[model samples]
Target: MEHPIPSRILVFGGTGYIGKYLVQASVSMAHPTLVYARPSSPLTPPANLKLRDRFRSIGVTIIEGTLEEHEKLVSTMKVVDVVISALPYPKVLDQLKIIDAIVVAGNIKRFVPSDFGCEEDRISALPPFEAVLEKKRKVRRAVEEAGIPFTYISGNCCGAYFVNLLLHPHEKSRDDVVVYGTGEAKAVFNHEEDVAQSTIRAAVDPRARNRLVVCRPLKNAISQLDLLSLWEKKTGRSFEKRFLPDEELVRLSNTLPDPENIPVSILHAIFVRGGTVGFELGKDDIEASEFYPDLKFATVDDILEVFLRPGAPEPYRGNFK
Candidate 1:
């Protein structure tokens, strides 16, 4: 008997927060990974430069080009079986270029767009957050219209990112935590690595093709108050709970400008409106845990434990600014 060769993967925005994990997961699973990133110059941030060097050392082929380069995107897409885009929210519409290139290449087995967040199609959020979801929905429509084989990932809340923001584990001197709404709305918080691993698995999975792969493990589903209590137990410290009601969240969402209101609106959606856990998985949907039983994913408790460590570094906040 012979083993099947791993699919070749091309990752856009491969040096980003979640993108790095996707690239790593692809390489770990023995996929010949390639990264299409902006060409680095002296103006490039040192951290980004180091990430590129690290990827090079790990044998990831780096293709230097922007999304505007249609010829380059087409040529690059021609060589890979899968294209995973981890571009941030601001660049959501930019995926249209990738879609055009995929159509021209006509060989990609799967095209996973940058949707490692909530199930946009199902949830009704505040205007700011809804705008973001609308952009993602637009991309989804484009992909479907182009007849591209694809997978849409709704990985829910990134665990470390949210835990750090909500709990402020790094701020040891801080004595209080913000409890959104009544702190009882259940939401899914998945580790970034787990999100990436499951995404990589689904990119090659026939069952996941053209399906919405949701990363909602049972253990990871907990309320804001539950997360607060867990962190309290882990640190053996009781912090003051500052409750921010839904009305105030909405007010802030309306008052705050641009990106600032974006995160606040998201908080209202997930914590107050129960955006993540609100919907039922339809016939087109598949829960990641059940879909990939063999893949072990870290829970909220596991993520909290990391933050409890003395020198645990903070997770990248990305666009949650």
Candidate 2:
């Protein structure tokens, strides 16, 4: 049962962190790629303009419009065979409008919504994270009810991004690392590039239609202690370990002062309560690495080696460090 590759692929949020990689993956796979971008606003930053130019130079088709413009979205969608949404957390619920546009367009073969963090259907997160998941779930329900052939990608935590967050790898000056909970609960951390590649692959595969494709590489499935110890070994330096007990995480989640800082609550769910530890390899899960055996995966050790190398670039220094 070979699934035919999509000739024209459309990506929403194609300039985002993961979206940019998806755009490149689609192009590299020789799919005629289209990116849905909003028309440039007066306040649009120069960096964004440069990103658009970069995409254009590589021959990506740009459809400039808003999700509010239903007719425009439908007209644009009508030309593509598959649609992949990489809309970020804040805009996740906006996918329902895109699903509506897909229904109106009536030619979309497969739709991949933005379930790239965790399996939104299963985990019970704290208020902040749960609200984000709930919006995604709403989009899922709408996709199902609209009868859109869909593929839900459960990519777990992205290693390049989340690892920096968890271990503060960019902060070379730091003498201590915060160990969430007992630092014993294991979680999968797929690199962002792998997530994008697997996502684009699933979007075109008939076997992936109406299925949940989870990206859980065995080597990348690690705990905070595993990451901390690995970093220490790589750097040949020992640092103080500060443990954030599960009880403290719960207390902060319940009493955080600012709602925007609610990521504290989400981290509590992931590290303390083991929220993102959804699938075990070869046991009731569709592991992407196993499903596509040819692609090499990045493990936590690999990540630590790169980020801890001499003169390594501080990618997330400003915000994460």
Candidate 3:
């Protein structure tokens, strides 16, 4: 059980929302960090370009290539001790290719596939949510079959983003907060950065080998109504509470005209059915925070502050119907 923390780390989606933080945390922790990025381009947005430059400033080596380059992937893996894939949702299955490369390279001490949401294997969600998790499940099976030592991170919801999605945190002008189901089901909501850091901790910690690290910060677990009340107290305004019961959500999932309205359906699973209800720390799972107690996790109130900031990104206009 005693193993040295990994000194070298490689991140596949390093420029992404969560991966960027992983790269930062790795570098700050004094690990030699590398990030996989596409070849530079004039068409690349300035923000992305700046992020690449920033990673370089903090000594993160950026490897330029695509997943199709199996030889290149193997070559890159040969230099690192850990591989953390933070690939976007649609691209989750592409990690199968990464698994193949890891098997070929054969030196990876820990492989953390991108299951940064709920514990998909344990939770039975609707088709839209299940379909997304099936891709990740494939990657997980591939890694295990390949004899790779792995750690699965089920960090539940990323508080800021999902809270925005669930509660419409950025919609200050809105006179009401929609309450999904009875607004009484509690779920874990770890800050995305905390999720990233805890994942990195698990990747290198020998104790975490072949384990499932659940990020259910006790303080971060609360109901939709708990969040609404917090927001109301923070703003000193009681927004109208509109209730969207479970039956209505299920009906909407079945009847919505646009088959592409899967996002709405996913919301039904998380808010109505309680996507993270299956795993509770001390009752059914191990807590990632127990491994790194010194790390301070942001509270729901802290997350709300960020979303409520002036000129915060516009409220998501997607399928919140």
Candidate 4:
């Protein structure tokens, strides 16, 4: 049964990497979308200014504030039916404030936290990455304790983003790619747009409430070698593959500086350890593609074709650089 009124969505960190896509998806879904983002200043990047302009032009309500502002968060929570946090890794714990506000407001129907990467509860990653996951786990425990209607999204690897990192599609002169492990470990790589759209759909879904929804389409699953093969076929070029074994990834994860080590550790887990594909989803977990059959998600080939186009922009590097 379809509801007559659309859910009002308030997105925290909506101007960040995946957050922007979430905001776009929310608005595209005809939700009365509101974004709680940092106030813009002359110091803000031109690209970000352009994004803010685009948001305003499209009728998205932008509430400029910080997560620290308790009153503002509570008031905002009062207005929206769904609250989704796309706060990056560093700000994972800050959602506790959002939780506090939700409790005070007592009006939110659902809360989607910033667990958009791996299923933290499942895999055992390198120490650096495991530390990050621990922080997310803390948020999960808090949300469950608060009894907030929530959906934990395990989006796996973002398609174009990881593809750009692995293939260097923007660098025409580059002729080699790094393959983690033997390049035999398969992982899911869902397009960011699909993840965003499915997230929005799941945020309001009755079945998705209080469950973990994984964005793992069978067609999107492929090994590093398979991905390379597809890219080589698309560009009509064969590049040399340099294999980075598990020991080297372990060394980098251990030796690299604080946050610099974090990405390497994550790469170790996903590429070398097969962290994304190691476990089967529990019975309560929802595989997004199967749950929403009508939503057509892009495959790895489709993403490669997008890169082959002239003047295609480089995917957002995020912290993977």
Can you write out model 4's per-residue Cα lDDT over 1-321, one digit (the tens) per residue?
244258999998888888999999999889999999887888888987788889999989999888889999899898899999999888889899999999999999999999898899999999999999999999999999999999999999988789888898998999999999889999889888999988999999887989999999989889999999988888899999999999999999889989899988888899888988889999999999898887788988887888888876576756522
Better of 1 and 3 by TM-score: 1
Task: Residues 48-112, candidate 1: write the lDDT tens digits.
Answer: 98999999999999999999999999999989999999999899999999999999999999999
Tell me the TM-score of each prediction against the true structure.
Answer: 0.97, 0.91, 0.90, 0.97
Off by over 4 Å in 4: 1-4, 319-321
Model 1: residues with Cα > 4 Å off, grouped in runs: 1-4
Off by over 4 Å in 3: 1-6, 255-259, 280-285, 308-321
Model 2 scores what on Cα lDDT? Answer: 0.81
Pull out the clashing pairs in model 4.
Answer: none
**lDDT values, one for every candidate:** 0.91, 0.81, 0.80, 0.89
Weakest lDDT window of 10 consecutive positions for candidate 4: 312-321
How far residue 247's Cα lies from its native spot in candidate 4, in Å, is 0.4
Tens-digit lDDT string for candidate 3 (196-314): 88888788888788888888778888898888888889878888888988888777767766545466566676777777765444443458777678767888888888876776544
